[model samples]
Target chain A: MKVKEIMTKDLTAAEPTMTVRELIELFYQSGLSSVPVVNEEGRIVGIISERDIIEGALPGYFEVLYGITDMNHLSQKLREIEHDRIEFYMTPEVIKIEEDEDDLTAADLMIRKNVKSLPVVNKDGILVGMLRRIDLLKDLL
Target chain B: MIITVTPNPAIDKIYWIEQLCLDAGELPVMRATRSYLTAGGKGINVSIFLARMGIENIAMGFIAGETGRAVERRVRDEGITTSFIWVEGETRTNVTLLERGHEQRPIQITEQGPTVPPDALKRLLIHYKRALNRARYVFLGGSLPPGVPTQFYQELTHIAHQHHVPVIVNAAGEALAHALLEKPWLVKPDTRQHTEIAGASLKTPREILAAGKEWTARGIEAVLVSHHITHDLLITCEGAWDLEARDVQFQNLLGAEDALIAGVLSATVQGASLLEAARFGMAAATASAESEELVVTDRTAIERVLPKIHIEQLL
Candidate 1:
């Protein structure tokens, strides 16, 4: 089977400008472990998994020691953090496969990369689908 | 509640090869390949198919080691509820090599699954008893693990009977033979498995039907025999029928049988007639055969082929 044969065509993608909070909500509503971070042209640029969002939202010990530490330095750091976009936190090195690639090629990449999913792209580098691990397993039976 | 019992489940690893050579190492590197993982077993396949068909069910089975963890992760990812007993051994992994060409034939290599100890088998049976208390249908499928008694399905069917729940047996070999004595509500054995169990070299539909009748007389409520050319033969308490399919472009044949069973169960739940259920099963199987992947037929595909499938009643 080819990547196009099993990859989910209807994909929920995240944008670079989308807030971490909004991304978390989308993940919850969609029940997807991760969402592809796409550009305005529908090109996959990055990916943000559930682990990334969870870790991003975690309360840091530095926040608790803000009053005890340098107040000016803390304020400046907080401002920089708030100004950072999802692009800054998202995994830039995205693993992707072409839609026409066969299943073995995609499986080998996934196994080698130890990834659960990969974005399926067209010739023009437009995101079309997401080839998930479960989709491949369906072919085995 | 519906409970699916998979005696032997595997982590299905599918590799899409450019061209599958007879030997794995000697294959020419002409094209690219890809792969994906899924929790696989007859019962697990049924559960996922049921979920896709909008049926809420819990999958129950024995899992072990890392492969078991992968199975759990994949199943949970699909949003299917599961309650499996973790055994002592590692779960098995089935490898499927799909060659992309004008004619695609999947080369499936299944591993010898984990062996269950006597105590582990005993624990599994006890868990089944608990699960049966609330389940209306008990689906048992897949092979028997090593060291476990061959009569495991028979015992489970008996338990289901005590609870007045219908049992569906999708198995072969000694496990199937022993389960037949318990008179399951449904027994879905493919053409090859049916011949193996009956010890017959029968290839014609008439011969297969005669064998189905023999099993029906032996106390099986229904024998759903799936064939290559024919649609399927449903030998039930009411009568027998030959389900014929329209010629279509065949793609991958993987998971066609499991999809058929799921389709039948869906119809049964909706109070459809046995013949109607058989028709649905045939349509679903055809849908799977026509798709390049292991998928259930959508409403459009089923409707398009429904009228073309000829069901001949034979009492």
Candidate 2:
């Protein structure tokens, strides 16, 4: 089977101008942990995951990892930057697979890259669909 | 470039249930065995069909919140250029429940979309005016969203005319009323909302023909109206045609009208005459009606039904 046949065509993406609060609502409504960020032409420019937002919300995330600050004090600061745009937090580098590729290739990329989801694109680099780890396991089970 | 505008766009959801429990007496739990979701609106549907036919077109309108984002994604996936202006509330989602035994009568519940503010319309006009420079044809379709004036399409028609671009309007009621004042190049009164056209109830074929003639006589270039699923009547400056498609297998009737318009646009862009293009449009509508998918993507499905369309000239 091709990736296009199995990929989730119910794509929910975000624009560069969308705020963190808006992205949170998108994740909540779509039941998705991550979404690809596209330009005006709908070409994939970056990808943002729930982890990125959660970690970005924590002002002390990096300090906590280095054992510098207590993790329990991470409150009230999230509200301060709710208006910050997702473009600043999103990883501009994205790993995307073509829709016409073999399904196994998509599975391999996800497993090897340790990504929970991958944005599916066509030959012109336009975001077409999204594939998650659970989607890859559907046919197997 | 062809620009299609859908003032009220939606994310259409269809759920196929084995047996839908419609009993109001008892608490019902309906589980869908299958489901499909896609971007929907007359103009958006035509954009998808046109994109599949390798006709480059831009999908434009006001979209809001997450549903709006999904609509854009779905349209982009179909290779359409998107120029949607984001507004304040969530875009509406229309649900269609298709029961196993009763596939003919699908239950649809639609929500009124976000009220587009006046400023949003201003922004859209500015963008639309810029887009008109490259536009070969502009299509204004669907109902007017809340907070929008009834004469919005008519005003847009005048703007398109100022640029020497022909405009096609597919609307009903007041929106259709105002559009006629400007004399759009082609008018297709949306009969789905109300079965009335040109201030007359469309109960009989003769009435629909009369309604088409009424608009065409007022200096409108053409008027096309659906008589039923398999039949339609088209009136143009040169003549009128009553078109019908035979051997149509009833599957899903959604998007058939838009498919017809898309077919006509796709063929007309390739230099086909209005009569022949309307024939192809009927064939496309028949093929779309015969398929389970909302929009038929394969060109051969339309080609297979082309010869079966019977077009009889009137007047």
Candidate 3:
């Protein structure tokens, strides 16, 4: 089977300019853990995940240790970066696969890179779909 | 038609229950008499209130995923037209737990919306420009989604200005600061949001007035600050006025600001003076607070509160 056979053809992509607020909303609405960052020309530029957002918004350990805790302080911290563009936090060096690639190759790349999903692109490097680790497992079964 | 933009819209899930406080690591059991979800976002709320007042408006913004679709559907169901840019990902869900026993204190958790890519943003802008062709006013509300520039509202204001459509911005902090540069027709920030931009504590009404004056001098046409429902201050290039509604039992103060904006817009579009608009806005806010709903729809309710609204000139 090729990558396109089992991949989620209807993929959701994000823009670099999307703010953390917008990303979280998308996450809540779509229930997707991560989303591919695509540019205006449909090129995959980066990838962002729920883990990235948590890590990006994480306060310094010193602040926590020093008892700098309160809804006010936390909300303030959020406001500081809530408007920040996604490019600031997304993994810019994206690992992607081509749509024509075989499922075995896609699975191999996922294992080698330790990534859960690979953005599947076309011959022109345009994002066409996404292949997840679960898809490969279902194929194995 | 008025166009309101909620760049990051949400499905506001309000849980109404009794007994909210709980012991550590223990869950407090309670039952909800009624629970409901509404399409929420500052811009969307403004549109709802505007529609309630028989004002036709379109709600425009980004909607993603299933939740986003639901928001669009619900808003459309409210008899308001929607022109949303369908982007990848989902719209956010804002949960508000209303504790009726605990003095009606509400705890809210908000989710950030999807990242709007450049292409999606371009589409939204194009949609907005087209909407502006028939727009009498533009209400840009709420915080922006990720990947959107901090100065995004400024661009919207610029576009509205180009079409001779005055804009009213209801935002906070950096977003409000950027919009100020574009000189929106009016900006209604809560006390905290206004003071954050003022870089000083506007503890007194006089101090808030001074801050509003400074903003007007910096090219902004008007600044309205709501001081915790006690009073609302409106300062414009024409003059300054302090608006207050006395002897009021507050019900739900959720969409008061949006209602206020709707009232002002409602008055302004009908060739009313800024002072008259401010008066009507104050009345509208009072009516909204007196209602269990997000915004007051009955003109009688607004009229009942109109006498209570006191607007005094300060400058």
List-wise, what DockQ does each model earn?
Answer: 0.02, 0.05, 0.04
User: How many residue pairs clash per model?
Assistant: 13, 0, 23
Docking quality category of candidate 3 according to DockQ thresholds: incorrect
Q: What would the per-residue lDDT of candidate 3 be over residues B45-108, giving only the tens digit for each residue?
A: 8888777777878888888888987887688666676667777877999987767744235678
| Residue B34 in candidate 3, Cα distance off native in Å | 2.1
Question: Candidate 3, which segments miss by more than 4 Å at Cα?
Answer: A1-141, B101-104, B192-194, B198-203
In candidate 2 chain B, where is summed lDDT lowest over 10 consecutive residues? B122-131
- Say which prediction, candidate 2 or candidate 3, comes out ahead on TM-score: 2
lDDT per residue as tens, model 1, A1-91? 8887777653356668766655554555345678788775567889988666534544363355534455575455445455446676689
Model 2, B139-231: lDDT tens digits are: 999977898899899999999999999999999888888889999999888887778754777666788777777777888989888876678
TM-score of each: 0.65, 0.71, 0.67
Q: Deviation in angstroms for A125 in model 3?
A: 38
The lDDT for every candidate, in the order shown, is 0.74, 0.83, 0.80
Q: In model 1, which runs have C-alpha deviations exceeding 4 angstroms?
A: A1-141, B22-34, B101-104, B198-202, B297-301
Please list the Cα RMSD from the true structure of every candidate, rounded to 1 decimal place.
15.6, 7.3, 15.0
Local lDDT at B87 for model 2 = 76
Candidate 3 per-residue lDDT over residues A7-100, each given as its tens digit: 7643367779889988886677556789888776567899999768755776353544555456576566677889899899899999999888
Model 1, B1-315: lDDT tens per residue? 677888788998877766656565765553436776778898998888777776767677777777977887676666565656656668899988777763236778887777776655764665566556557888999887777687888999998999999999988877887888899999986454446664633366687678778888877788887666546878976788888887856766777788788888877887888788878877887787777557564757765767767888888
- The DockQ ranking, best first, is 2, 3, 1
Which runs of model 2 end up more than 4 angstroms from their true locations?
A1-141
Model 2 agreement with the true structure over A48-76: per-residue lDDT tens digits: 98778767877447655865264445445
